[model samples]
Target: MRVPVELDPDVDDEAPTGDTITVYDKRHYVTYLRLLDAKAEGADWKEVAQTVLHRDPVADEFRTRRCWQSHLQRAQWLSREGYRKILEQAVANKL
Candidate 1:
């Protein structure tokens, strides 16, 4: 299930899981979680995280809040653009 990703410098994406998406950043952890809602469900958290985030180091601030786990509990709170970025990233990783 390993895949490769070629980052585009022009794209604003760069945040790791659990980190806050800056106004400038096109994607973030929350975005990915939202996309997973329709793409997968129940017990798919780990897979979605691994695939979208690739286990990138999450920020300490976000980690303290356990935001990723917390989001898993709620399960649906991302915006449309956020969701699109998640699917885009997932597709990018496949290339």
Candidate 2:
């Protein structure tokens, strides 16, 4: 999707707590899909971080790993809980 890798420093590392969809979630939908796929295929985090998430592991190992892990966790959360709200939003938008 050629999505930009400009991670917002202000956004929390954790996913939204409630059944609410945020602009960040909407923007990173493709990213979430990529993450979910990578995880299901057992792809290495280093590869996923640099290739998918576009973070340089060599420059900052800790931040790169943390970002990858946090985002993957959030993606999993979205699959389990957040997609319902997003579906509702889509239905509302169509109406």
Candidate 3:
């Protein structure tokens, strides 16, 4: 059960179509985070919402410099059920 984290709208929903895989907000970010959490690594959570992932030149730049790190810090809260909790919520939400 993957928790469905809301993806940012400015992040674009066009789903990339190329060899270069650029993940937006909740797309692979959530899955990848779950993978890492399972292995005791890390993942970011805050920027999952579409609003946060905005691609607006100014907004993106601001998020890149300001929100990125803080969002990733959620990974530190990992625990036995932390990943499970996230997944459950994510799956329920669906990207």
List the candidate numbers ranked by lDDT, top first.
Answer: 2, 1, 3
TM-score: the better of candidates 1 and 3: 1
Worst 10 residues of 3 by lDDT: 12-21
Which is superior by TM-score, 2 or 3? 2
Clashes of each: 0, 0, 16
Taken over the whole model, the C-alpha lDDT of each candidate is: 0.42, 0.75, 0.40
Q: What is the TM-score of each candidate against the true structure?
A: 0.30, 0.76, 0.27
lDDT of 1 by residue, 1-95 (tens): 33323332222223333433334234234444453553556545444444443432343434423544544433333443345655766698889
Candidate 3 per-residue lDDT, tens place, 1-95, comes to 33345432333333333223233333545533543443353323333322343433354555553443333343333333345654666577775
Candidate No. with top lDDT: 2
Candidates 1 and 2 compared by TM-score, better number: 2
Off by over 4 Å in 3: 1-60, 79-95
Error of 1 at 53 (Å): 1.3
Question: What lDDT does model 2 reach?
Answer: 0.75
Instruction: TM-score for candidate 3, please give it.
Output: 0.27
Q: Rank by TM-score, highest first.
A: 2, 1, 3
lDDT of 2 by residue, 46-82 (tens): 9988887778789988988888888888788899988
